[model samples]
Target: METNEDKQAFEPKVVAFLCNWCSYAGADSAGISRLKSPANILPIRVMCSGRVSPEMILRAFRSGADGVMVLGCHIGDCHYIDANHRTVKRVTLLQNLLGYTGINPDRLVLDWVSSSEGPKFAKVTRKFVEKVRELGPMAEEMGKSLPASKINVLVEEVTG
Candidate 1:
């Protein structure tokens, strides 16, 4: 049984991958507009969502992010003129891979938010944070599938 301490002490950490041209700017706009979004998310600004490689997402999970978000331009609105195409393809594949590996695909989210959509950005961030808080700690659930040997390697990789 979970203690009251567990419930009161829970603070989910999230990693947000934001496209520099749009979603990152949207996040900035949200801040400028004084929209309240959860402070749990740590945003990493990339040139494009297309640049978020599989290794990076997996590394985020392995490094103790309870949830991850990928935000970019709309399907037809990529600043790189189709850069988001690769993002769509890659994230779709990554979602499936996460599911197969026994991780909840819902722990990851993909959305499009233009720089003008500060409200949308704040809403999405708040929603994702709440969802992660409900889902509890991912690292604990993941331990069921991870072998001790693999964990040792992962620990060394992260800590060394």
Candidate 2:
């Protein structure tokens, strides 16, 4: 039988948005190179990191992601020419906004990675997974503020 302490070590569900031209390739490279990465992250590829809007991120949270990550080309390496700038700004703001709503800002991470940095991808994902696991589940944290009924209603509004 599993002890309560064992149950307390929750595995978080993470949603990651990766730039198609860079971060996504980096993640693929990590896999091809036989690097170990946490399976908790669910990746969604976009043409550029800038394409990941706050709404999409909020939806991920509303859909029950315990953490979110946005990985893009290193500063100037964006295939779309400086598009990652928007991602940088928006993600920063979203992190603060989520914090204001009682969610820990650390739940969101933004980083840069190149396609050739396979080992770096594995390292980053592992670190992020560990960080989120320590923070525990979003649903439990959210439950302290609002009732489940309210959360379901908000989710419906967002989804619609």
Best-fitting candidate, scored by TM-score = 1
| Clash count per candidate | 0, 0
Off by over 4 Å in 1: 144-160
TM per candidate comes to 0.87, 0.86
Q: Cα deviation of 16 in candidate 2 (Å)?
A: 0.6
Flag regions of model 2 displaced more than 4 Å.
Answer: 1-9, 145-160
True-structure RMSD, every candidate: 6.6, 6.5
lDDT of 1 by residue, 37-125 (tens): 89999999999999999899989998989999999999888989998999888998999999997899989999999998999999999
TM-score of 1: 0.87
Clashing residue pairs in candidate 2 are none
Shift of residue 121 alpha carbon in model 2, Å: 0.8
**CA error at residue 134 for candidate 2, angstroms:** 0.3
Clashing pairs in 1: none
Residue 148 lDDT in model 1? Answer: 73
How much is the lDDT of residue 135 in candidate 2?
79
